[model samples]
Target: MVLTVSDLAVARGGAPVLEGLSFSVAPGEALVLRGPNGIGKTTLLRTLAGLQPPIAGTVNFPEDTGAYASHADGIKAQLTVTENLAFWADVHGADLVDSVFEAFDLVDLRDRFAGTLSAGQKRRLGLARLGVIGRDVLFLDEPTVSLDGFSVKMFASWLRDTHLALGGIAVIATHIDLGLDAPELDLTPFKAAPDARGGSDEAFL
Candidate 1:
């Protein structure tokens, strides 16, 4: 799968956040977004994932081939870990629930209620859904949040084994370095200037 973004512009609260950005990701490739907070990395990911419309430019990718994982995790609190994975597996017609559990070291927590899990555990469960869905293009936002060092390494290994190995494309927005040598886009150059409500923005001036 290939994802092509041409001169993309993204906004927040009716104000542009990122502008004149463009890139492409081929199958088996990963593109990392790097910048400080509030630089629109989240917005750019959301726009590419089709969760929000871009202010300008084009994002071209096959329909239904993309999956997005935000920082929120989006787990059903009352559901068991396996139950959550099952729901998505059913939805996406993917039958890798057990494998995903093993991938994230959740085999022991299969029957545990998501509500009872700690923050890092829930984050793992949230990310595990991506594996179950089996989408070709993944848009991830701060995917390493609340994870310990080992878990982070495990997550990176999974990305290497499953997604990239299968010729999938990934666009990740994160501050932590997962040690992947993927090409990076620093969003500071693309940040939108503050409007008249703020003082003259030297970056744009």
Candidate 2:
């Protein structure tokens, strides 16, 4: 499947931040989003993931093919690592895939309560949710925050050797390079004018 964004415009706090942006991601491909902080990488990802409506243009992709992973860990602290993953898998109408534990290095902590895991572990669990669900397109923002160098490499390896290798598509907004050999889309030129399209309170963050 292909993911396409056409002349898209997105706003933060009712004021536009990005506009007239167009791009596409083919199967087995990933697009790295690059720009200074607050440059609307998150906004654009949200728009593409259908989390919010774009100010203009369109996002076209196959149905039920996208998953968005942001800073939010979405971990149920009360539950164990396995249970947390199981919950999300079920919610996405997918089986609790055992491979997720291996992918994110959660095997040793499977029985540990999510609330008790270290910050990096929690981050791993959150990211692992992406694998648990059977989606092919990923929209991720700062997926490596709190992760150590080794964990980051593990995540990168999973993306390159597993996800992309299996025909998955990803659009990630992260400063660190995952070495996926993917093309980059810098949002610098797509920055909107200071007086773009609104003066309301729906800021992009």
Candidate 3:
């Protein structure tokens, strides 16, 4: 599914976080959001995912949408990888087994417990959730954070390949290089004006 934002504004802690920010993601397109820490990168991704309400403007999402992956894995520590994926697939009504597991090289780790996995492993599992759910639009925040160099490269390859094969859009916010052909959108370029309280504000499409 395609996503479009226009004149979008969001406030957190009674302070303007994002304003006048505009960007769009067509099918099979990958858009990266980059900015310094605490610049509302996560907020913008969450807003695009429709998990956060905008104070002004609109967040447009396509009709056939499903699934979300936060910075955290969202998997139960005690559960096995197989169990976690089964639960997600059931919730999202996805049935492709080999494709999802092979994409992230998780086929062998399916029987391993999530708690035993390394930080990079957990991130891979979290990312794999996106494919299993068959979501039309993928919203990822700092997807490569905490990942080892090798794992990060692996994910970059998987993201580019899968995005092309499935014809879906991936919106990622990260400092690390994804090594993909995705376009980058620096949120700082679209700055917000400060309100009367000496706070900043901005929005987008």
User: Candidates' lDDT values, in order?
Assistant: 0.86, 0.90, 0.77
Please provide, for model 2 over 70-167, each residue's C-alpha lDDT reduced to its tens digit, 9 standing for 90 to 100: 99998999999999989988898888866888989999998999999999999999999988888999999989999999999999999988899999
For candidate 1, list the clashing residue pairs, or say none. Answer: none
Name the top lDDT candidate. Answer: 2
Candidates ranked by TM-score, best first?
Answer: 2, 1, 3
User: Which candidate gets the maximum TM-score versus the true structure?
Assistant: 2
Worst 10 residues of 3 by lDDT: 196-205
lDDT tens digits by residue: candidate 3, 1-205: 5688888876655466778877788887888888899888877777777765766788788766834567777888899888888888998777848877887778889899999998888888888887778777888888887788888887887777875456888888888887878899888855556751332243332
TM-score of each prediction: 0.92, 0.95, 0.89
- Steric overlap count per candidate: 0, 4, 14
Per-residue lDDT value at 105 in model 3 = 74
Query: What is the number of residue pairs that collide in model 1?
Result: 0
Count of clashes in candidate 2:
4
Task: Answer with 1 or 2, whichever has the higher lDDT.
Answer: 2
